[model samples]
Target: MKNAQKPDHMSLNSLVNRLKDGRYVIPDFQREFEWSPKDIQELVKSIFRDYYIGSLLLWKGKTENFDALSCEGIYGHQQNGGAEYIVLDGQQRLTAMYYAFHAPEIRLPNRANRAFYFINVDEFMRENFDDAFEYHYQSKRLQRLLDSPKAQYESHQFPLSVIGTGGWDLLKWVQGYTKFWEEYPNTEDDNEDHISAEQAEVYAVNGEQFGQYIKEITDEYQISYIELDQQLGIDKVCDIFTQVNSRGIRLDVFDLMNAMLKPKGIQLKQMYRDVMPNVDWVDTDRMNVYVLQVMSIVLQSYCSPKYLYFLLPGQLKPIRHSDGRREQEILVQSTDEFRDLWDKSVSSLVRSIEILKHPNEYGAISPKYLPYASILPVFAALESHIWTLPALERLDGTRKMKHWYWAAVFTNRYSGSVESTAARDHQDVQEWIADDDARPALLMEFENRMRNLDLSREVNTSSSTYTGIFNLLVLQGARDWISGVAPQFDDLDDHHIVPEAWSKKHLPGNTWHTILNRTPLTADTNRNVIRDRLPNQYLPEMFESSGEESMRSILASHFISSAAIEILMRRDFGPNDFEEFINERQRTITDAIQDLLIHERLDLSPRLRELDLDIERVELALRELVATNLEDDSERIPSGVRQKVQQRFEVAAKKDPSLDPENSRQMSSLLPHFDIRDIQDTLTNKILWPVFSSSFTSKSDLDLKFSQLASLRNGIRHSREVDDVTRMEGEASVLWFDKILTK
Candidate 1:
């Protein structure tokens, strides 16, 4: 306090102007710009969510101090105005804001491409934080979209670059967007590019709403900063800067909340300290914040940072009634109530951690290999809620919780928007537990995601899917080849099945590092038995020692098929043989994942299974028929159909770059991109109808069979509970397709 003035605040609008005016400078000794694109996106999301982004520490510097420190303007800073303050802290936050708002044509640190940020209006309106903010590298496609007014209106993206110039630029862009959409409603021709008057009005309204909201946030949001007096001696300033940088600690939300609770006599810091040791087994530094998150979830069924503030003892929390009415309710009206809730939340967190660590439950083994630590708050809150249910109901709730947990992990649901995801999952899973029919959308999402699951691409040890697969193997009681028993929790290690040493020599790149090629084994077994040798070299030895049946059983526990073992043990084992083994193992893993996702009570009957198989065969037959008939001439396909399929492939390529149309595995045909709906489009195309007319009775008949098959395929794909009558209809349609396509 001797050298620094009290913390003061300014509007975010003023902050941006001051930054552009080059009033604040970074000292040469400060760390370089280090925020990645993801970090920048999160900062933007925080700002829009109205969460505090931390205060800055700046030294009011004299000319001599500036010269001595060798300070310079922030990166991409254009104005040469003399520096008024030398920033000691918050450099990364300030620079990220400048880069995003300024939209400088420069690459991010350690990145090859220049980053561009945009707010997706649709996602923002829907409150989907995960997709609300987006960043993309500068590309021709991006440029074309940005240049086209129609495209921008259709995509509902508001570029953040206009913010740095001034609010006027944004206003003008919004006006232009609204006018363009209004003028081009396309009533004359109802084509793909046309929109109805109703849609045009909606777009116009959204554009104005987006602009006004951004302007309000920019103009009203306050940024706090502490200013050190220039009168302070140079040594004192230098010492202060070093101390601030070296400590690497900031007062986060938990710190602020702790102080807020003190006036209410809650002593949150003391409560957290008492509870921390119990949850110390959870390997994360943000345990304090997680505790608050758990409390938020339990109280309001929401734990986002903004929602956490509602946990204050006297806060008037809004409650919506089942009859479409809302009212204010004091969530924690007294200190005693707050303490009771806190104690119960801590107890629930302990129970959740125990369940996670237990081998038979989630099989996370330890906090070290837990797929997603971020999901703990929701998991704990749900556990607390479930404990309040009747004994018989509690058992059912726990089983469903296990299924939801795996679905969340395999879908990577908590990768971003952790708080929002937590709130939604808590609510959805609770509903699902109470009602058998109220299956959460996440289950269907998981099924769709698993249908596309390719384990060979899961290379990172920290990824949810990668760790999830390992946990699945652990839950399977993966017995070590050497001991023929499950390894101790600490002794278990994920070792490469094909041997990293051999794969490094025979395969290209990091293909050997995939989760498909790795499984749980004892560390001792990895070092002593499967040491740097090919599977063929060592597996045969294991088979002889353990007997073929015992070896197959052990491998089955690892999600390794017997067929894969046979391929690995072939006398002529080579890279191709290795490929076959990996493909088969990937299938085995996929099947296990599918099995885990199925509801125990809603198990598919044999008729439903046959319908699924028949649907797959029909897909393959269509692909072969298209390839044989069209000679793989993609250009001959209808422009609309080709474009739609191309869009699907492009979106798919984001998840797996190998899903390109050029990829040979799709059989050089467009059929792979064709869902049952898309298949209908292709079959009904006027240009291509002649080729298909010979196989089908007529276009109407083709439509009837497809409508039935598509409905049934969707039911299977989405895991919707089906009646016997609907199943019969689906089977009849599948038989019809088999009869027609086989001809």
Candidate 2:
């Protein structure tokens, strides 16, 4: 690194002249132009008020290296100097100033077109200022006001383009004002003419003051810059750029990478742009970051979140070679090696994207639902091996890859510590491919991680987890509830089954927004037909119009089983029956999630069944233990324990169809009948723990065992999968009780 020059203040006029003469260059490593109209307006206002706008950092580089820029219109006559100054910091501020003064019109990020104008201070102060002397002059808002039909063009509102071009002087401005008065003259109304004369008198008296302010803004306002010597390297320059921009959006790692590769005659941006159009499913603007991330991962096994400087030529080396040259640590010496790495990395990225789009694989139709973008690099790392192989030869590997991907999705393995998880998984998956014994272990690890994930829990529509599963369901041919047509992801709106208005009035708090009640539909169907109506009312009408086949299709699309639909068909629209309907539908959704996440996995199914059988045996043992121990003191249960037992009993009692003769038989058959004695008969170890003999020495230890058993029993009875840790604890508790019974 070379020593930087001392900071110096330069006038705004001189800076603008440098910009116009193409003396200032913006390097390709700089971020794209992103300043909005509001940003520009505020910057102009600050400069007008003579506020300090901070310093700029510039690198004095050779003219040949400054051929490309992130944006245009900063070019004019090139100076005959030996070296030019390239802007490394303050690009946005300089770009805004240059466009405001020189360009004919500038387009904003929101696609709004605007032109800059000098403020009419005298007229504005005379007509709008109060006694306090504070005035508001928002540039864009004021420009819109002046452009309106009812507003007259003021004499002082000169276009900035003409002012910076040396075409307008004070004498010419005065002549233009006189010509304007001659053209429009005065209205016949005495009051209007009197007001016009008052405005004219104020402008005439303060004309010199207005000219002086304009001169001060255009010529005298100073902008400070810290200039770096031309001898500095790209690495040092990138470091300075990143350090100075710590407060705002810092430079992307890809930006630094692009600069490092420029000397080799390779452009990272153009390479990505050329490959982007080939992948039609990707939204280029949104997924560009992921693509760059995948490239980094393919080149190096790990991606550092902060920087990619380590991947440059002198920093990294190939560990091994195809020629068995393991003794030598070979640096990336030639452009050939760089070009080969780029091609392989991009090929891996394209393959990963294709795999995501495969309907039978992850079924990721879009990037909208990608919960962890960090996982994409893992895919790239795995897919890089199959790049040279044909598609048919890679089938088995792809299948194994998809299993891992789905396991990651359901288990949320990449959720909290994303970068570290991606790195670990990348190395693990690579090692598994090399060693045959590691494959089965990897699959088992995936199964264990996924065992306890409760997909039945309600999720909001905007949640990434919910969206991921929803997209997968749609890709499996889920149809719209109204039209029975496969709905497009972008076109679908999340529709509430039992409309929110009626649910709030009848059901529990916000129960209508749960995953079970929400499904996708076309915007027209959601807004026009399903607006604020009960399911019983609209569903019956839909059935009548669309017939049974269509109605069943709609129900199935939302993962509602035929049995649940039958119960819904017979239910009444009365006040208290909606909760029962939601419960039945929720069970149906749980079953669908099980099938989607663990479809046709024979090993997982048998393990789940065996786990459930063990839980049932533990529940029976607990009941026997409670009946034997608590027979003499059944009525002495603690208040807290009794309250929990009563809550469970009340819930079961409400679903007893005998209480409501109008309820469906299917719902009644699914629910258990509970009486006061039933609660007393099956005493959980949690409630009767103190009554146990001194053989169970530690109450805390026994409490943990009973808690695990209770959780396992509830999950088994309610058709949920038990997690591995809870299962192990419950099994150990059952064994301890069994030994006591045998003794």
Candidate 3:
């Protein structure tokens, strides 16, 4: 970190230009790419807004090598000036800007902050746009004062910042900050100095208080990225990337796709630029970052296997190394295969979720499994021809029943390990396949269990086994989906059906699967979905208010899934959409599962209705027995309560098949499903630990704990009591009701 000799700006500048040539990409040994969507957005804002972007500093040295980095993103510098290109700072911004600016359209692959546009121009325009005009960068209302093309060209660094949202916004912010400081220094604090409250009140140049602030800056300054050297190797370049750039802005999943897919064919590039921004029935805002994490893993298998995760511009990407271009190519291919496995993936996922309901999903033995990856099951289900009208009646019975769990487990593995070089290396993977005997042993036992004719066995959600297999299918499916359209399995992100906070707020984090948090989406579309704070059925405008036409158009086009749209209409609400969101998600998820699985022979309609209305009638013959757990007789239960319970049971039995017979519980046992133990294991591993705001309180009391729940419960419960329509009950809803009443 010692300061080197200070060469003249021109000397340093000359070296800088050479360091940026294509050959000087980052060296194989460096830190992983780390940045988040929020960071990405902030960086864009800073540069476009014109706040002083930091300088790139470099030292002369051949540092220790760690791993490998991709050859793209960093321009190569001539080694004539130095042995290895050295980077001082601004690596993140440089990499991001390089890739983003080159691409005609770059969508944030992260579910968040993907919406900002990079300047898109044809090749001729890209090379000559500056030559055609009196390119002026107005700062402090300071125009470039251009007299000729030479003056504009020689004025400063090339107009590296594209004239678009990401670039323009950053330029504006910096310029605004500079102008204010230049005009009225000493008026106030440092960052916001040079302007007074009185002036702000008049012209409204407040400290990012109003939207106009960004506009004001953008109106004046244009981003000027000054690279001191283009000849620097990636190792040195990365040092700069790690240092100064934009503070908070980083790349998302889409950014990863752009980086890895940089050299792929034009068709691939077009797909990346255009089609990848529009995934079907996926919500990018809620799951973009997590999706990026998954894609990073997938992409790494192809071009830059070891450090593909590091390819992300900022935070949240998981890779930990430098050189990984070869690894990245392998990942790309693998991801393409995975996308092709979409149907099977979704099936495996749904089944795993069902297993989660069994309360064994997070059991001690397989507590690592998360429902998120269970998506792979959907793929398996499809592979097994489960997407047809009827599912497979039976598979071979195996001991451990891990057959249903492989997809989910694989998905979890994919998401977790891609960032680690050793984990992602081809040699390591080969060894794993050959030596991971524990899982192989379990798979043998699982197939044996599957062979038994248990057509009626319900899917178990809690079993880590089921969730694991589901993820595998999801990974596979994702690979399949992107192959033909997107090269090297690039530009995908997970989309949230509901915003992530829903799970974080309503369920324990332990109950949540990182994989479960996302569904693959095109990177650009992912960015469009930044936060998913708004209900999907009616997307809100970021700037302007939505009129009726826009609202109608949104629900019709974007909802994509018919059931999701229906669910929105059914909810009949707009106030405090967070609550409506949860309800709508129930319908969306159930329908998607049914549609995708096709063979489970599920009836999604039942899922659309609320769960609270379901009731299990107590059999007169079994009441005495079922009640034993509730009683010290009168000692534990008050007379009024016992009477009410008995009365309710009597009423339910009048038309309820579960209670009409002498042995209703016995009759219920005959229903078709998977192994009871398997289901039980799933529930234990997963659902056993769901959290609620009112963990120990009833649904009626849930409101008192958190305002969101309180209002939701009140709305749903009260609306029902006042309803005139008849309702049918489903087990899922019944489960929901039971949790509410018991907790």
Best by lDDT: 1
Which stretches in model 1 have alpha-carbon errors above 4 Å? 1-8, 27-33, 56-71, 82-89, 139-151, 180-201, 225-246, 262-270, 315-329, 601-743
Tell me how far the alpha carbon of residue 72 in candidate 2 is from the true structure, in angstroms, after superposition. 37
Q: Per-residue alpha-carbon lDDT of model 1 for 1-743, expressed as tens digits?
A: 36357679999889888888888898888888898999999999999988878889888888888878888889878647668989888899999999888877779989988898988887886678778999989899999976875677678777888788897888887888777666654665654665667767776777777778888999899999998887888788778877876756656788889889888877788888888889989888888888888999988898877888888888997778899899998888877887888888888889999988877667788676798889899999999998999875776677788789888998898777688888889998998887765677777677778778888888999898998887777777789999998887789778988888778888998988998888888898999888888887898888888898988888898888878888988887778987788789888888877765443322345566666767888887876777677777776666777777776665555445345436523436356676777667777888899987888759998888888887787666544457676777888888998888767
- Candidate 3, overall lDDT? 0.34
Kindly indicate the candidate among 2 and 3 with the higher TM-score.
Answer: 2
Candidate 2 achieves a global lDDT of 0.58
List candidate 2 stretches off by more than 4 Å. Answer: 1-248, 276-289, 305-310, 313-315, 318-328, 331-333, 354-360, 387-393, 431-458, 507-509, 566-586, 599-743
User: Which residue pairs in candidate 1 collide?
Assistant: none
TM-score of each: 0.75, 0.45, 0.22
lDDT of 2 by residue, 181-208 (tens): 4344345563444445555555555555
Worst 10 residues of 1 by lDDT: 596-605
User: Clash pairs of candidate 2?
Assistant: none
Q: On residues 351-421, what C-alpha lDDT tens digit does candidate 3 reach at each position?
A: 43344332222211122334433132222232233223222222211111233233223223333222222
Considering lDDT, which of the candidate structures 1 and 2 is the better prediction for this target?
1
